[model samples]
Target chain A: MSVETRTDVPPGTAAPAEARRMLRTLARGTATPDRLRRVGAVLVVGCVVFALVSLFDGLARSGDVRDAGQRIAVVRADAAELYRSLADSDAMATSGYVAGGIEPADVRARYDADIASAADRIVHAAGLLPADDPAAEHIKTISQQLPVYNGLIETARVYNRQGLPLGQSYLDSGSKLMRSTILPAVDKLRMLENEALSRAYGEGIAFPFIVLVLGIAVLAGLVDVTLREQRRTNRTLNLGLAGAAVAMVLALLWWSVALLVGAAQISQASTHRTAATALDDARIQVLQARSNESLVLVARGGGSADSEFTKLLEKVLGPNDNGGLLADAQQAGVQVESIRSAAIGWREAHRKVREADDNGNFPEAVKLAVGPDPTGSGATFERLDAALGLALDTQRKAFDDNAGAASAALAGLMAGPTVLALIAAGAVIGGVARRVGEYR
Target chain B: MNTVNARRPFVYLCIAGVLALGSAVITGLTPPPAPPSTATQEAPPPAPAAGCEQQKVDSLRPEGPLPPPGQMPPGSTMDTILKRDRLIAGVDQGKYRLGFRNPTNGELEGSDIDVVKMIAQAIFGDPNKVQYVVLNIADRAQAAADGRVDVVVNSFTVTCERQKLVEFSTAYVAAAQKILVPTASGVTDVKQLAGQRVCTSRGSTTEVVLRKPEYNLDVVTYPNLPDCVLDLQRGRVAAVSSDDIILAGLAAQDPQTRVVGGALDEARYAVGMNKSQPDLVRFVNAVLEKGRDDGSLLASNQKWMGQQLQVVPRPAEAAYRD
Candidate 1:
């Protein structure tokens, strides 16, 4: 009846005694309506802020994931266009040779289109990336150098048109520029984009742990407060406050568990499976395409044909040696071994074609390899394509799975936090009102 | 309670602000330095002085006070032939009569081939002591600069700028730049080819001449004259233009092609040596002078090149100075 009598017994109290008295008073419910309302407001505000921050963080991470995906797409497109340009150039050269000097209009058109498309994609990619990024810098360098290379090609074309001896020089200079500068830059850009993608994946999946811990802590604190209030009040519940607490706890639990599961699934699908596999496949595809094209050029018959082709073939298919193309491919750690092996078979087939060509047996080599019957470089290209396709498929699946999980884990999480926080506010307010009513 | 409680939020704000400021300072003040392995080092000091030596041959005193035989510059034609056991001189592997590669052995053999061999003979006293270094049209200058070859004698036309980097003996072959076109193309001169594509090999003086505003022809460049001819036959270009001798060789190979223009510019081919090696230049000039006087030059020209053009004239009397 007189819990207030402790006021006189507390003078000169020991520290533990003081703490115990304070605890007992708290247990006895000195909480007034206004104080309860104030405390509830603070708790509600804090939870809401926390929830909003988590939502923002998740959204930011989602942005990173999206950006990474887009960048990869751009890179893939650019690489494809570059490959098309190189192939078209080779085709033009062959056609021109066969025609004795005149490149077919269609071949020229194809070459032009490929160059234009590659340039457009490079420009678009540059726009997409920040100026400071290495990929952007590389794109800029390529863009600047393209005109110089084109100038040389134009000079060659003009000379060829005029039946002049200098056309070969122009073609040679242009080819050298492409080999030494543009291609290397593209390679570097691809590597940079891959790095960016990895960073994005990390950002996308990083917040789950922090959110889980915070959610659990807040839920536990609310529950403890509710039970203590009930025990002191000698009531089954402060109905309003109890309802709010229950809602908040449920929402928190749901969000935490749902997000954890979703995040795990996304990590498994996107980071662990899809992106990794896709990147590997893409790299291999690039290598195969490049090697195939180089082989075609090196094999084009002339003085030093055998030696040049042999050197290039060895570079493409041989074991790792410092500064060798094959060594670089290995360092890239793509599926290069199988690709190289396939290249070796292609090279053998190409040699047969060359022999046939040299022996004035064009139809035989063309029929045996590039023919519709499927036997030569054409078949090898198809095989390489299939391998790349498989790799791409595997990585794409992985990406989708991880992204889906990440996105799903965050599903309904934003709403859950807000609702729970409001409920907690309601419970504290209601508990204080009940106490106030009883006193009155 | 109202005033004190209001002050509490402000205190929290201040604390948060301080923490943020501290974090910013820490992050902003320090950045890790790039590792040494990642840093690009200065390109190794351009090969030692042995790679570059002073010209010892006095052009003014062509016959006086010349270095004794076999005492040429360290990296001269003679020194290189002896050291590498092969002559590494630029020779045309495309020009059939001048210097074309023998398809069977891939060895270059022709008039120009004989010239390089003569240089080798002069150096090692053995005409067979030569290693032929094949160079594309664009690479001749670079090959010489990078020390890839001892000299560039691939019918190289001497130029003033080229003289700064490499020394030249007395002009051995005289030719002129000309335009080669299809006999059916009706192009007879540079004037007729205005606005039309004229092809020339890169790094050749022909390109420099064609690209000049005076020529006003759309200059197309190829790695070699053969490619230009190929391009011309394909109608990818309107004409193939290069030195008259090269054009003549192209014309000879393919009956459909012919040199259409008179000499666009006279080019005197000379033996190129590293500019720093004057002693070697003197040795080469001495041999050339001897060949000129003894009629061996004429005999070799007739034997290898199939024609006697003109022997280089000897230096005439001039006012002597101290």
Candidate 2:
């Protein structure tokens, strides 16, 4: 120590080796200012690294939540809307076929709107999905098959107007195509979009473990170094090191609180997503039941249309009409009572439709099934569908609000880590420089 | 200081773990939807072999001229129908020119429909009093047995087997099974189209005849005659075989097709009634007696099918089982 160990480097020695020797010399001294300065330098470098890592990671996470809230949710809804419109279009077409004189203007207009909306949604949804996503293939299949289905419906309409039974045949083939091809594709696309939305949610709130670890380690190092210096100098506190420790503590605390809140919001949003899909599924079943009912009359009770109605009815109301899809939807926190009651009423009306047909009162059956009776199967099903639509809207709004809050909670998280870490680095340098200057 | 706040991070982590676990548990409560089944049901096994030997069976006889409209005999089926004020007639709406609903006006008009109107006119005095119920060809006998309809005028063919479940009136119209083909195909004979796909209405006598191994042809059956015509038009089948009248109506709608081939089997079209309702059968026969004598049934056949088919319709002469 008296010889001033490693204070001067030997001539021709490399700078790095000289520096290493100096660090070793500083380590050998107990309660020395040089060692305190070395510890402070390490803490400053740790703070710099932590700052860079958290800054980029925080920004990326914020972006993920924004994309999930805005982009993924929209695409998911578009896929759902596409499925509904296609099914509704077929129902309208079948209804028009049964009403058969000249096509009813309202039915025809509704069909046209459904087709137009379906096409529009397909285009919009395709644009939003990533080019390499598996969802793209399903979108392609639906777009290709839709026009073919429409052509068949048009041909059927012409024949129906002319009172040709072949028109019904054409209509049957069209519906077959829709069920076999287009609907299945839309179903797949919807599933894929939902998966993407969930992935975004998971990524948005994932913990930044490395940054927090580095932050805690730097704070501990600074505190340990400052305490030794205080004891060595017989002083109570070092202002510079104390300031750096405080900055580290505040940044870590803010990050933890913000992420926790954001995670809660994102999780709630996911719940809404679950509820919405349930409602969407119930709505689809309603449309299909309507289609099957009308086609039975249009085909004049041929084929398996009657049995198909039974199967579809069971799908919604369960085997006994007490619980099924509506029950499942209820478990998802959606209000299904309205849909359930309307469905029960619709079931009763459908029973009368079948009875009249069985009793050889075909005109009476037609009147009960499709006539302007306010309590008929058609009107009751319409009410059920409306209720489902309303429930879906509520869930959608809930999802949007929660998702937006999730994004908002991430505020300042990106800048906080970087700014606080820079402040810590400055304090560490200032505190160590003061001691080293006194020794000089 | 190290011990004082060291457990704070652990506490926060515990809270976070609990929250995440709760969410996962909640999500797991909903079982994911099962994938839709892709399998289609197989068609029902071919109908049971004819239960009885085939034979020509004359329908019930007309005991007297039909009671005057609005003056039905007490305790008769007609009287009950008059009390209800509407004759519920089960008919096929798909058989064009026979019992089809006219799309232009939504009115049921055809030869078979004409028979129903006559019966209603006889009982209720107003032809408009009849309420039409469109039935599948397979349901005609069961509908009668159950008393679900007052009468069936769906171009029904009489056979000994049907007599077990239903009673029939004197034939108001006569028909024979024939094959229809696209005019462009130039295939005139059923034998020439052997080994080719042939279409017919499901459960019809023609379906039975086409499946006979000797024909050596593939057969496809739809719910109605027009459906077969569509298959033929789409080239999915080489020909459609059905009653000549129904085939004639289909050919009339699409001029590119024509009815050909000889009559494979002949059947008499009569008003089908419940076996228990012998009085109803007699009443329907009385009404048919008027149509045959007055040539009104022939006039209807001519008016509905004359342009489509050149052959003049021959109504069966009145015969009596009792």
Candidate 3:
């Protein structure tokens, strides 16, 4: 085997290796600043491009957060307006009912004003909302049904004045329409708005972990490349490139930290505090309005108004204390204690009114319902309404404060990132240009 | 060889780094699809209570043969009441004189209250045994049909539509549709109230008559006749329209207001029962006939109303024979 084996090598391979070695030796012999500067320029430009891209992306993300927050704030405002309009409408119904035959002029005017305001708010909300949004759909459904409900009320009023038994039927029908259709739609709208708000809050306050990581990575890469270049080439420092790298890293750190702080503030204001309180207060107001309506029916009789009211109240207010029918009695008591007391006073007034009715006292019941002394159910209802209004105002203020905080926290956030990123790009370009000049 | 040495490691590292970065970016950018949200469950259907359907059927039955004057058949309403050991009747709990609740006692007592008691006496022979179910005007007919109550005596006006659903006994009380206007209003009649707002309780015959173009009143309907009265007082409406009996009740309740218009239409009051219960209907008719003939009805009416009522006169032949 040793005799037959032969080591075959290409004739030019050794010669080529020798030539490459000679070239390497010669290059080392003439190791000059020009070739080193060319290599440094190439590396510097590549790093600068990567850093600039990362900075731009981070800036864009901040813009997205700010935009999301604004959208949520707008929707929240719309939800508030919707709630107010519905509450005002409920008040009007009571006022009109107590005023006898026709609602008082002022009451009617107030009713009209509420309706108009609600319509206007719906229009504005619709414009702001995407057509495909669920909230928009709810708004549309409410808008369509509101007119029908109003028409039914008008018809009921007409029949009632004619002394027709059907008047009661019409009025009952109208009230049913409101309960079944309009109110539920309002609830849906509120829910949808809340959803939008939550989504915005989430987007606005998203953790900046990704941007932070990228910033640290780029900074590390710059430091490593600089140290390597300095050690290998025996250079003291590449001042222009070092300055650009430092400027870019500092800008990234500053922008990222500021954004993180803003995001945290927004999360606290919008997600944790304002939204939850507003929703709770809104729900309470809805329950109170429903309870007031039920009490009216109880007085009417032949309507199972009391029983129905109880059932609905149970559904809305939840189970009562000591397992009684009025479980939420305490909450209701707190919210409308004055109204409850007024209800007691009204009952006394009603007793006298009933006696008068027995003595042929139609006028007496009418007088009791509309008495100016603030002792009637109507007056008590007004007091309860006032209380509810105060609660609503408090909730609204909380919402505004939180929403404003969330919005304000994001202020200058977008512009700051964009401007810093631009400055970073300028530094990177300047650093690369200085290296290129050394190559020249 | 030098070029290959320089390019090979860089190309491999670049590929590996790009793949890792690509995967990370894709994972971050595309969120997982959300799980299907549970929808809010709808409220469970209301319990299938016994009365609603039964009441509808009873309210639809055609009138059968009239009972012999003042004499009920065997196993009639009176006999059934004795058998069941309970008397159930529908009444109102809102009408002041007709039927109103006494908050002090949480008991319903009024003229209509007395009438139901009389029927109870006629049936179970004890008025106290009568179980009164308060119903609105809309539910009264259905309540009768559902057999939830043996009779509906909720100031129900007899009408053709109601007759189609339930068997009505002979009219025990006569009433007419009338307008209740504020004393200050110049409007006196339905004709004079054309284009003027008049309020009435819902589901009452008053709504139907007043809204008719012939009456031409700007009719307003309310959930209760009381609401209509309130509207009239507030001047939201010019008058309140409803059955004259209700109007009379209203007037009696308020001396400041009165039924200003003559009856717009003749309305007869009858006790309603399910059409399926012909024997019971016959018995009720017999009790009513006897009560009228014996002046018990007259006395009860006078006691509660503090005045005379135009009781439906018996047929001329029956009066002559008697």
What's the distance in Å from true for residue A106, model 1?
7.0
lDDT of 3 by residue, B141-251 (tens): 888887767788877877767766777776666767777777766667778888888887667776777767787777666545766665565578888877766777666
| Model 1 stretches astray by more than 4 angstroms | A1-31, A70-100, A103-110, A123-127, A130-134, A207-213, A237-341, A350-405, A408-416, A430-435, B1-153, B156-322
Model 2's CAPRI class is incorrect
Misplaced by over 4 Å in model 2 are: A1-64, A97-99, A131-134, A172-248, A267-398, A411-440, B1-52, B159-165, B168-172, B191-196, B264-268, B317-319
Output the worst ten-in-a-row residue range by lDDT, candidate 1 chain A. Answer: A294-303
How accurate locally, in lDDT, is each candidate?
0.59, 0.79, 0.57
Off by over 4 Å in 3: A1-69, A271-377, A408-415, A418-422, A425-440, B1-151, B155-322
- Comparing only chain B with the true structure, the TM-scores of all models are 0.71, 0.87, 0.70
Mind giving the per-residue lDDT tens digits that candidate 3 earns over A1-440?
A: 22222124355566665665555543443333433333333334334444454455545544545554456455656666666666566556554654445567776787788788888877887787887876777788878987876776666556445433333434455566666677777766766666655665665556554444444444454454455556755768766446645765765665656556666666555533343343344344444444344335323432233344344334433453122211233333224344334333444554454444333233454465455657654565456445545554554565456556545545555455445445544554565456446644
Better of 2 and 3 by DockQ: 2
* Comparing 1 and 3 on DockQ, the stronger one: 3
Rank by DockQ (best first): 2, 3, 1
Error of 2 at B15 (Å): 20
Better of 1 and 2 by lDDT: 2
What fraction of the reference interface contacts is present in each model, in order? Answer: 0.01, 0.19, 0.03
